[model samples]
Target: MKRMIFFSAVLGIGAVSACGGGGGSSAQPIAIDFAPLGIPNTDQEHVSYKVTDKLIVTYSDGSKKEFPLSYEVLLQSGDQMGSYKWGQLLDVNAQPMSNIAYTKGEISWNPDANSLIKTSDGKYFIITHFEEPPGMLYASELDPNTLKVKSITPIDFSSVGGTIINCAGSQTPWNTHLGGEEDYDLNSIYSVSAGGKNPAYVQCTKDSNGYFTGNDVNGKSNYFCGYVGGVQRYLKDLNIDPSNGYLGDKFNLYNYGYIVEVAYTNGKWDVAKHYITGKYTPEMAVVMPDRKTLYMSDDGDYKGLYKLVLNQPQNGFNKNWCGTLYAAKVKQLSDQNGGTFDVSWIELGKACDSEVKAIIDKKPLLTDIFDVEDPSACPTDQGFKLITEDRINECLRLKVGQYRSSKFASDDEVKKAAAFLETRKYAAYLGASIEFRKGEGLAYDPDNNVLYYAITEIGGSMADGKGDINLPNNMCGAVYRLVLDQNYNAYKMEGIVIGKPINRDPNDPDYQKYGQKWACHPDYVANPDNLKYIGYNTLLIGEDTSYHINNMVWAYNVKTGKLTRIAWVPTGAEVTGVFAHGLVGNNYTMTLNIQHPFVDTFRNADGNPVNSTYNDQNKDKRKGILGIIKGIPAGLLKLTH
Candidate 1:
């Protein structure tokens, strides 16, 4: 739900003109009020998208005011295994149980992921999303009876201050919460655009330690708008309008972009940062059966997969932080979308927070972490000290999965580079493959001993040049399955589900005529992301794409290889975070955040109109929607043309 979606991020600026017209914000003021469309009743509480939460707003006088704030729900859905679904909206109040709900009101926005935690002692849920963590592990307790928020209390991480840029996360097997800090600007030198989703997939005209000179189609440097970085307080360069109050967060910079572990046990909560996790633009982490070995996915294009191997496993992620972080080196046996590949892990570095902290305190320059140079390649008398911008940039050419093992002989140098400072670059130096694009969510099927990774897009110009998944004209998206063995080692990684793109030209009049068939919507799925394994080898994929009319959650029966549409959001909205959090018998509860639903007159992430609705165009502008669907009976969902 909390996607660092590279292209989506670029479009999030809403006002910018990019690959297409839709996605970003419009410059004009609000002129039209809207309502939920296609629903049977206007009296439905779920259809009203207003919020009453008081937000801390600041004025030019340096004074602050409490204003009623509303949010656009981007991703929503909680645990979906309970008898009756119970839903909660970030801004709106709605029941967790329901089949159909209209996202109305633009009051609340960007609610990320919801997880239903049901226990013999009690039933509860946890939610996470955008730049709003008031504490490291804080929670506003809801009444045990009324379920209304009563008061908030900090859980953990009070020492290092609370977390920032808390993006998407995954629930652990041990009843803990894992949220990754996915701030794209961490390195100063951004590989992505300012606030963009996955930089690897999007067409970035600029990347730098110097001035970005690339021009938009209009011949203007979008970099001037605080898009590129790699210098001191680089955000100052983006040229965001001060009056629009569009300046970036200084907290937006450092101490973010890590995997945060929150433990909820004994009616209490605790938090910690796994410094050894080896940071990148992280999406989510999936722990294996041993609990000591884990795999993590980064959100950007051309990014590599990572692993954490604890020296010893703790009951929970206690104060313990010592571990070894490894970057994956993939051996592609085939060039197909679901090709089988041999996998290897390269040891990056090992340490607790103190060791990492010391290096930061002494030599915190961006390149200082990997301060060692290959003396063999040295210029006679000089030894390698600090890497330069050009030097790191050269790493993009290394062979995938070849890290630290052979080509690079400096053990200590590999230690620092692969472990700290600049991780993604270091992995590239070791030759770890960075081919995955827009890697979003992680799901582990213990029953099947296989894991799922969603590559949101495979083709288009985004897949051009070297790293193309090249499925002919494939554009929608694809999901890869990593089948693990007895030791949780990935033995087979192949494409399991492929999204078929509607190949017809958009301008063609018959485009709408074929819209009713599965070929148009994808017989299996489209632009798949955020996979949740809901037992019985079934995977629930939460979707996002400007390519499709509406983003939906598709149920894929692994055993049967059947794809079914279970639920979808309003136009301009993405049905994300199909969480199986609350699981009890045939019924389940999933809290879903309906994000960025545009009004009939409004636009989407790509800056396109909600297209007047495939269901009905008379509807009003879509508001932030938070609702739950109960008894999502598995298999094919009946569709209408």
Candidate 2:
């Protein structure tokens, strides 16, 4: 019956009642149809392109002009297949700098928080590297006026303590950078020399006896990247052992998964983990207008969209890290590919900073004298130190609430263990929806109190029998939006836009023969990753696709319901790090990255060269940055929610 209601609203395109339940039948009604967003993305050149059809956006009207972008390359990586002398570098006054550093790829423009000492006399930027030894976060200062690099320095995370494979982050209203690592939930970095002025990390393979060994480097053992039994995911993932701390073993595993707020407040860039925001496979964080409320996304299986309300809004994360975390449970009101629905938040747990710190303090000693090779010790010994025991099981034994059993003394212990430790599991046991995949990038409209998020894959959570949803499986992906109550809690949740696979041929491997199996467009926007809202209810969708698509960035107007392709990258790459510069005005510069493109010039199957992406100016062909500044159409500026 609920499925029928959702289908009536979504697939049938029925309207949702204020009561927030499906009352209509699941039949496609002959309703209004909007034109397609934009034409297929052109090559990665700074030229004007056309929209697919006569793009008539409701808000911007059919007359909105598409402007050409004038870009600037701040810094490039120096990896083996790198370009330039080592890609490229520009000094403070836009002058070319001679001294070069490492190949730091996924980039973010900084000065997130005003620092006392200038790393560079101009603007500050940070970049991250994946799969590289001693994964690092580098700061490059650029002249504000000319936007050129003045100096470059590696940020030492030891003071804050953690060997972070620094990934994507969001610039907070506090002027801080809250960076989140992918696939790094519950992983620990415990080597004393992990992340410091000069850091050393271990890369190791585990033994059957619950121990990890790394190659000898300079007479010292390399650090372990995974917990004793925790999975060692990938290059940029959390691989360090939990017994090993991030900066030191006692520094702990609970330290890594939460948002690491990197701020420049008292002269230097400092990092502090905000554990109040229940940890998961974190991707991005969006602060509501109230500042006290935050919307965070998790990019992992069984991940759920989360919201947090701080005890004090005026007191920033550095001082006050006490808050209540909630996971959204959607009651599907619609069933369209990009339909609408109501959402209710399930309170998972609450925490204070000091309490979480104590958990981290015990991380190193989370041990039990368990016999090795005891098959019965599997789940029980996972999180403990045998080397490491399954502390997760110990925590499980302390469960309370609906999941409580003979293992726990009270619900407080269960909440405490699950609050900072097994966040996802804790939420799931509370009946919070844990059926999402790749939920990343968040944007919100304060005036309307609506939050928009990207669900990169249209499977798992949306599968049959979960929520009783009956919408078509979008092989491409979709953007979901939630309308929040005044308290910044979700009252409704639903899809707004869906991805459709394009440009298919019988010869293509992705072609679904009987139309049963399918893949999205390889050159179009699919598997939407990062999202940025540029006023007037316009949401930008960036891609991190697996469909072999030369990923692209798109703009979806909430008012007009149009998905326009604005930017694109080359083969073997994902469109990452889309941030709208904080400059106030009608028109502003949007910073973007063409991350990790193919080192060599790519060619199509017909032996034709793919020229637009390759930069002939630099020999090595490395990743680069772009700045896109376009005018907001007149209609868009005067529009309101």
Candidate 3:
């Protein structure tokens, strides 16, 4: 999470002396440590709050202050869905759709990201995204004092044709929420066929122009092949009927996979999809201080690391959707400790959002851009290049000359469309390294001119020792630190915090004593997902993994090279939406969400549910939580060493 640092006037560094018992002499910096959470007992299943229940602050004068450390639950998923303001699907006339299920059973309980927006009038609203097939976003008015929900208003995405799998997001520098759509449907866009899942949904066949010939594709009984099928499901969930004509005649795959900006204006929420930000399964897009440059993390196996630089820096990124897209091609420096790399950018293409959106509006098929053939049958003599993208080996050749569409005047125009529309495949064709596995979260440290990128796991093509990324399999994952240049472009990367893999056998000598049955070390972070930069030397990491019984949130001090566990979730839950909202009063607060608890599907060695004990202890198995950890002293956040 990227946030603007807030320094309290009352608790500034100058006030340290006043906090030191009003002494005339200056006080030394206070020493602070968050007591780490211990490993859960063998039979333990619920959340373990073994970490000290207090924030201990020791002054140079030997005086100590202990503030209670507790999590304040702001909203629960089940509770929100059961409320009146939970929101319902709207029709073409903007009226709530009737007979639609709005209960907890009908809606998803997975809360992924939270962006707290403070309006100019001192009003606070948190935009939360639910990770579901048909994703949902809601604006909850938060009480400034307690950071609790006062009212909930569902943000309508019907204007942008709705979104699917809304994942991790960041609060933009312009004070709006920038969300991502994790559209994995693109991976199978060329493979899945019409009526593959349900024959009753088959409507019409594609014409020679690649457009639907008959019936409304958004209709309940209408189904299209590839990416369109995914969009059909999303529309169906929204209760959109064929007769209503809600994107029923013209549905495009490119519209669904991009960065979405949501802003509260004049007491209403407005949304826009930024087509210029390329298309991929984006986990989060972190904007640099320049505001025009963005580093977006692609969340999938064999994906590319994307960067977008908006042309009009004076107007900032939100002004217009015109940018130059680039992907990283990394040369491995070493394979030790999750590997190090020398990173260089490969310019994909440049175009405005409207230009690409116009091409997308045509509803072109995958074959319209490139000729794709199986790797084994690739005709190298015919200029086909063998490339691995999305872990699929394919022979691809960009179309040219007479093969080009008349709508696009030049080959450059078609290339630009291909660059933004089929980003991953196009990057591979352009020779950009696309072997990253499970790229998760991104955080920029402007003070150090560094960017922190988290790779949730290391496997697949990344460890095959045949591609750009050749490393040992480390399912435990690692957080990489990228050194950026004056232009905010990452040039070098190395693993800063790497998880240690251990024996998983219960009979192992270390298993009984240290609870090392998990694949990764229990004391350290595994599958680091959401990251929040706190202070000058601390980075907060949240986990989303099955390596450990309980997902944890850890604080790693960059200066000290120490990793301390700050919090953990109930069994089978991910620690997500980790945001460090700077000083609130005299104390600092950080927001976190526990997603999908007590729903462990991963099994233990004995073939029993890994969180069976937890399920037995807890009654509700599908509720998620939005909470905050308060009582952190402002002084702690000012630590430079």
lDDT of each structure? 0.47, 0.47, 0.66
Q: What's the TM for model 1? A: 0.64
Q: Candidate 1's error at 413, in angstroms? A: 8.3
Counting only residues 3 or more apart in sequence or on different chains, how many pairs clash (N, Cα, C under 3 Å) in candidate 1? 63
Question: Which stretches of candidate 3 lie above 4 Å from their native place?
Answer: 1-32, 42-52, 56-65, 80-104, 191-230, 233-250, 314-319, 504-508, 514-517, 583-588, 603-609, 616-619, 634-641
Question: Of 2 and 3, which scores higher on lDDT?
Answer: 3
Candidate 1, 1-641: lDDT as tens digits: 23211101100001111112122232221111111122111223222333223322222333433323223322222312223211222211112211111111112234454444443356454444432222122243333343333343334444443444455577666666777766444453432332332221123233353223333334454432222222112222344222222223322233455777876666766677766676677776777768777788877556667877777765555655678877776666675654556777777777776565444434332322332333234332432222222112321221223333342335564365346556776666555665566677778887778888887776432244443233344556778888787877775677888875553555644344433332334334666767777554567787766555555666677877766664545445565554434433322234444455653232322334435544254234433334333222211111100
Candidate 2, residue 423: how far the Cα is off, in Å = 0.5
- lDDT tens digits by residue: candidate 2, 1-641: 00000000000001121121122332222111223333233444312212122222221122222222234344444422212222222222222333111223222221111111223223444333222212244454444444445555555455444433344566666555666644343332123322331122233444454333332333333433333222121111233443244323223455556666665555566667777776566776767767688887877555777788888773343744788888877666667765566677888778886776665555422111111222234344443221111112112232334545433355675466565555665565566766676787777766467887887877655654454344556657788878777777778777777776643565655453312212454334577876766564567677766453345667676887866665555454455555434322222233454454543233333323453343354324443433333332222222111
For model 3, name the residue pairs that clash.
none
For every model in order, what is the number of clashing pairs? Answer: 63, 47, 0
Model 2 stretches astray by more than 4 angstroms: 1-68, 79-135, 185-251, 315-319, 338-340, 364-414, 467-471, 502-518, 521-524, 584-588, 599-619, 624-641
Give the range of the ten consecutive residues with the poorest summed lDDT in model 1: 5-14
**Which regions in candidate 1 have their CA more than 4 angstroms from the true location?**
1-108, 117-123, 131-158, 190-254, 265-268, 370-414, 460-473, 505-512, 515-522, 583-588, 599-623, 631-641
On the 0 to 100 scale, the lDDT of residue 211 in model 1 is 28
